[model samples]
Target: MTLSNDTLSELPADVARPGYDRAALTPGIVHIGCGNFHRAHQAVYLDDLFNLGEGHDWALMGAGVRPGDAKMRDAVLAQDGLYSVIELDPAAKSARVIGSMVGFAEVASGNAPLIAAMSQPSVRIVSLTVTEGGYYIDPKTGTFSPTHPDIQADAANPDHPETAFGAIIAALKARRASGVPPFTVMCCDNVPHNGHVTRDAVCGLAELSDPELSAWIKTNVAFPNSMVDRITPATGPRERALAQSFGIEDAAPVTCEPFRQWVMEDNFPAGRPALEKVGVTFTDAVDRFETMKIRILNGGHAIIAYAAGLRDIEYAHEAMADDQIRAYLDKIETTEILPIVPPVPDTDLNDYKQLILSRFSNPEVADTIRRLCHDGSNRQPKFIITSISDCLAQGRDCTGLILESALWCRYCYGTSETGAEIAPNDPNWDRLVAQSKLAKERPAAWLEMSEIYGDLAENAEVVAKFTALLNDVWARGSHSVIADYLTG
Candidate 1:
């Protein structure tokens, strides 16, 4: 039977449904992105809270701004905002219907309904998982791009906003006008210092239009930095079939690895869910945790994905099981990535790196190379390039990282080592192709993407080293390049 309140009782015994009273659940959070990651991570936490009967007042009210979100809204609302979260493992699997989401707003056109929904006093937290690129941040300056068309449009017409941050500003404006307290803006995206970046985006946009409103947000609103980790692949027919095996006919389901973690600073101003009651770790400082995960796990993903892509390895575990690929990842992490990460409280960095290796080698997870390698423009800046910056600052041996960058540049050339076609994977695919083509000739041409490389591209010493590797990667091939780097 389809997963819904009316059909909850009819679900198979293997599939779990909420035991708490769904009707008692109230809207306390208006999440701006309703994608699979949010379902598998934050919504799962809230679902656990509701099951405990403690966070009934903190139910999630889903919202989105992308055009594709309108379709997700229809699917979610069709099932009364109820969906199944199926955890994947090599041996066993489990499924549950999460009931923490109570409603969704119509976001097909402008975010009028979303603004109206967030304006309500019940919505005390406006959380988001709007991807790493959604924040409109300049990767070079690490500042909000006020000149972005959406920000420009929103600054011009704040009431009829077009972006999620703009909608948030409009809602805050309404709340201020109505004499309601502003909601805490929680950022659950995987960006580094996500809360600060979110603040820069919303507050920066606000300043362009209303200096007073920007001051109010700066003074009153809360943006909590968080470290969210889970390997939730995009739901597909295979997941639908898996759900059916559990006798769940959920139209919208999220599938992820059994492992999950959420570490965040305790900075919610307008009340929040009792997520700590679940597995979430609340801390006074989240910087160390975020840095550890972003560097070792996130950056390591880039290392394996790009290198694996060059080898045409299809899945994460398969690539990880490859001796050379695993060594490449460990070499980069231990020598380069780990040294740059500051000490996380009560956590051993080496052990954490091992744990990440085991997680990546989970065979049953079936995470694809394409999924990991997608969005290099965003992932490289936050995950890969940041570490390069630290290496440059600390004068560390960055040979592995330099080779990884060369692999990335080669991967962007749209072909694999064995003459396999690599389809466009980056948001700036055209630019990447043009630069890669030029770099194939000049070897220094790839650094011309200043928007991504920033001033790092102009450093003659660094460029010389990178160009040497780029030339070797092209002349000798990726495998020989890796093998020689390993031995040399």
Candidate 2:
């Protein structure tokens, strides 16, 4: 049976189905970028809330600004916004059909339908999972790019905007003009201080068109920072077949690890669902949690991904099984990254690190090395480079951190150690491959990409260490360099 409202009862008896009345639920939140992570994380939390017969008015209305979102809209709306989330674990696997999304906005040019959906008075929150790079922040300087062509075009045509931030700006303008209060702009992405980043993107774009409106949004809208975690792999034939095994055909099934977490600041002036009742952490110390996760988990991924990719390891768990790669992750986190991470509330950093390692070793999730190493240009700045910068400021050892960056440079070469072509992984793959070729002859050439390396390229100490390490990787194999680092 195809998974939909009518087929909910036809599912296997063991599979959990939403107990709430889907027809009775009303839209209160409009989530942009309805990807696997958002489905496996935020929407699942809402599903749990609805199961308890609460927050029926806070149903999610999915929205998207990108052209690709049209395909997502069609796939989701075909099932009436109902999809299955299959949670995989080492011991057991479970599936649940989430009924939190009530509708999806029609995708159109200039995001007219999306803006209209968000402009509704009922949409008290506009949450986003548009990935870390979606925000128009300069990778080098970590500031909003007001002069980006998309931003410039949006500023020129405020009523008909292109980017997600522009669409949000248009919606907020409609609300303000209609005398309705602005919705809380919540950012659920992985970036540190994500709320501040969202604010900068929204207000920065607003300032280009109208200074008065920018100030209004700055004073009124609430961009709450959040730290969300879930190991959700992109869906493929395997996931679809998993759904089929359960006698339910779902086009957009989300397969994820069983673990999930969301640490958010309680700053929603327009009110929010009582998500605390559903295991969401409403904290004043979100930054502490954000730092712990970004460095240890995300930074840990960077440490393992490139090296594993170079050696032709496919799954993340397989990389963790490799002793040298595992040791590199452990030594780097224990000595370099964790030492600088501040103490999170009621949590032990060592315990957190162990949990991250165990999660990475979840074979059922099948998280790919390619996904982990996909966007180094944007990710390294947030995940790896920031830790390096923090260690340098604190006079801590950053050799392991620098070595991680070198691994990324090597991975950009587009050839695995087994001579398998890696295909372009990053959005800037062409430029990175070009630089990698140049850096082969001159190690300093890789670091010279100031947009990625920033001032670290100019730092004599960093330059010296990076130059030496990268040269070793070229002269010796990646495995030898890693082994020497482990022993040395």
Candidate 3:
């Protein structure tokens, strides 16, 4: 008999579902943003801990920052708070049941339940996967954007706040008043020194409301920086079909690449589950890992995605499969980019490069160029800025990175090579498009916006290189430009 949806209740007798008495599991952690990356990364780790008979007292309570998250709430609830995760690799495929999350804290309705959950004495960790933009930070300045309407609303009402920063501060105040220990604020976003950024945003918002409370937060809260990696694509019909095939009635099952890594600073104040037993690397400095991953992997992603998108390549693997584009990526990383990266213990950059290539070439994942290309304004600063800075410092040729930036600027123009109308993805898409057009007319126009490129735009040599490459890209298109750079 084929595995049926009804058979899911009892884990097929043969397959042990990591038995943990549900009655003993209580919600001890509150997570914001119940997205795919969270499901495939942190939740998976927590599930592993629970399966190992550890973290039995800890369960996840999902919370959303936006009303659009209501759909995810409904989906997780339909599956008995259970979800399927498929890990795909070129060599193998593995599937697992993740049951770390127990309930949802509806944030759109009101902050009352969410605040209460955070205010729980038993809740020791308040984790986040609120993407880069959710930080409400100024992309140019790298500071909390208080003028943002969300931040403004949060600043206006210090006590009952809506933004994540507000919620955290309000919850912290409740803990302070009630004589409860504060939960460690763990940030799982991809930003550099995420803990520090989280600290700045939270305390920045808090300072606006009450200076004393902000000072208290600085003294008490522990923001641990983390480096999390898992290539999980957005769910589509194929993913839905995969879940259905497994006889699982999952409304929002997540499909991810087999590879995963999470490195964090070991600094939880109240208490934390011994997650190290389940493959979490707790270290003093996550800077090396963060820099290595962001510069090579993420930086390469930006380089290839924009270049490929300009050539009308649909998916990432498809772009990687193209010999010309693949060679171009290899040349850029090895020659211009890799030398600047500080060495990590036991990490062979060459081997890692090979692994990245294989992962990108995996046809099954179908990671889209457009998905990777979204939010260039926020992403480029982290992914590309450092490499560009390194090159400028050493007086090395940044011909390739400059070309990559030009491609990104061209991509923001919102029209594809085949004249297809590209939809806007970034919060600043309109601004990016208007500036890019003006820049194309006067090659340094966009870069001159000191806020984005800083002084890099005014440097005659850098502007000349970028302008030349931008002109070449417009003349011969993406592949040819890449081929020319690789050979000459």
Best by TM-score: 2
Clashing pairs in 2: none
Q: Could you give me the TM-score of model 2 versus the true structure? A: 0.99
Candidates 1 and 3, the one with greater lDDT: 1
Candidates in order, TM-scores: namely 0.98, 0.99, 0.96
**Pairs in steric clash, model 3:** none
Model 1 scores a C-alpha lDDT of: 0.90
User: Cα lDDT of model 3 overall?
Assistant: 0.83
lDDT of 3 by residue, 1-488 (tens): 12223445555333324456555789888999889999999998988899888887778999876778778988787665777887766676555677788889875644777888899998999999899877877866777777888877888887667777788899999999999989999999998899999999999898887899999999999999989898899999888787666555566878899889999999987888888998999987698888888988898898889888887899999999888888888988888788888887668887877788887888878899989999888888789877997998987877888889988888888888778878996878999999889977887886776656767886888888888888777778876788889987
Query: Candidates 1 and 2: which is better by lDDT?
Result: 2
State the lDDT of candidate 2 residue by residue for 122-152, as single tens digits.
9999999999889999866789998789899
**Residue 209 lDDT in model 3?**
75
**Model 2, residue 474: displacement in angstroms?**
0.9
Worst 10 residues of 3 by lDDT: 1-10
Please give the distance, in angstroms, between residue 303's alpha carbon in candidate 2 and its true position after superposition. Answer: 0.4
Could you give candidate 1's per-residue lDDT for residues 1-488 as a string of tens digits? 78778999988888888989999888999999999999999999888888887978889999999889989999999998899998887788999999989999988566889999999999899999999989998777878899989899989998788999989999999999999999999999999899999999999999989999999999999999999999988878988988888988888988899999999888887888878899899997698999899989999999999889998999999999999999989988998889889998999999999999999998767889999999988888788888888999998878888788889999999999998999989788998888899999987787767777878778887799899999999899888888987886
